[model samples]
Target: MPTVWVLGAGQLGAMLKQAAYPLALNVEPVEPDSEHLPNIAADDIVTVEREQWPDTPVTRHLSSQAGFINADIFGRIADRFHQKSMLDDLAISTAPWRVVNTDSTAQEMHAELGAHVLLKRREGGYDGKGQHWLHKDDGGAIPADWLGTGIAEQKIPFDEELSLVGARDKDGNKVFYPLTLNLHVNGILMASISPLSRVAHLQSQAEAMLGKIMDSTGYVGVMAMECFRVGDALMVNELAPRVHNSGHWTQAGACVSQFEMHLRAVSGLPLKAPDVRGQSVMINVIGVERNIGWLKIPATQCYWYGKDVRPGRKLGHINLNHPQKSVVQTALSELHTLLPQNYDQVFAWVKQELERA
Candidate 1:
């Protein structure tokens, strides 16, 4: 079996292993302290997470370079300024956006996006972390890292948030998984349902936008296009250039999960698009609360990372699948009851989601 190398010891890498294994693919995981990446053949694998760049010479040589970036590189991808500029030129609609320094003044935003703004640490923000919301005149003190890691956007009054987890191969071939309708509870992803509540037009639009992005960046791998849908208009929220939290529902919902697709994309193989053959509800287990009852749900697929927990920490996620559409909501509601509601409201240090608008 060809080895598929994934870097990181996080939840994303764990799920990638499960998906790649069944396809007779060898999934190789590299933890942060791992220094033996040379043991594996370079051609056999791709990365799982794209957040931090590795310090190892062997791994660094295998990952992204100027000519092309591999299937990883979510927020971790380089040449970000150029990529962001390209995204803007696509004339692809986006939420209110601006780049600021640690002490740069805030600009007036469009009224329609929302009466709030969301700040992201252009480097490591995901699953509702590394974000702060500004409502009214309450923009938090800008951190110095925001100079290099700063990308800010208007908070949108989206009817809902959705993500498209898809792939593009080196030959520019493309494949897409279903758009997952995401629901967030206090910035942390609460649940994601496959077979979106919206129509084909929206999914197609999202696919087209993502295709343009891949074409522009010359990116190859699994990517997810996250956006805000305000009424009928879909606006870009941000781009995650790897398998995303929203796509976690695909573990049980689709014919092939995103991890398998990532391997295929990096290996110069034909990419297989995934269809949501069944309704899937992926619920998260966040913070200090362990929802042991989640395992009791019928047809539930649970993955618990053996990580020590704290408030607002992402510990595990459960994917509940059903061929019948009826059980999706019931399963989600029940599992959600077991998870902790946002503890941010209780803590003074927990950043509020809505501030400077």
Candidate 2:
């Protein structure tokens, strides 16, 4: 079997390990900064997550640099799009935004953007961290921590948030899963419903935008693009250069999971169509440990990441797959009934989507 070395043995890496077995690929997990690279063969294929940029002789030997090893374009695509002109050139719509210096006062940003502005660090922020919301009435004071290079974007009152997970092979072939509807709590993703019923009309546009991004970057492997649905239009929110959270529903609800598709793409295999098996919803298990009670629900599956529990950490997720949307709704209702306090927001969102569906 061909050996594939995966850097960063986190949850995604573990999912990749499980996904790689069916292809007869051996996945060896390695620490990003480990110096024990002497034993690896030259031909071994190495892979890393988007945020992990390892610069070492072994990584260089595997390829000239870290991001270039397999998917050569990620070093540029992993972070938020730095220039508004870039999005315009790609024919993708985004909220009005401007790159601002850290020292720029919120008053100045408010003056330029509006009363409601979101300050985001140019790099390295995820799940609602590294962001500051400024209100016009708050005066000119900028958050001390936001005093660095970042981007200021107008806070959009979007109807909903959607994400698409897709894969591309070396031959330029591409395949994508259906757009997933997402709900966020405190900037962290709390739940995702795949094959969004209300926004089914935007699928083609989403696919076209994703295609443009992958083609423009000569991207290989799986890529995720998040968007905001405003009225009848979809505005690109950002891009994730690897397997994504929204697509986690694929593990139980699709013919081929996103993790497997990513490995197949990077391994130079023909990409498979992302065929949905059923109506599905994936709930993020954040800041809490797993409870067996959750798994007892019909058609529900739980994925627990063996990590230390923290207030905002993603410890695992629960996916519910059913043949009909009504069944999924019932499951959500039962969940809310079981844990009303913890799932109030989740139940409300799921109920709204179910009604819209």
Question: What's every prediction's RMSD, in angstroms?
Answer: 6.0, 2.4
Task: State the RMSD for candidate 2.
Answer: 2.4
Tens digits of per-residue lDDT for model 1, 84-196: 55677888788656765545544343243345766676565666677766565664445565654666677666776878888998898998886777677667776666674
- The lDDT, on a scale of 0 to 1, for candidate 2 is 0.79
- Write one digit per residue (lDDT tens) for candidate 2, span 173-254: 9999999999999889999988766678888999998998888777788889889999988998888878889999999899
TM-score of each: 0.81, 0.91
User: How well does candidate 1 score on lDDT at residue 290?
Assistant: 60
Residue-level error in angstroms, candidate 2, position 193: 0.6
Best by lDDT: 2
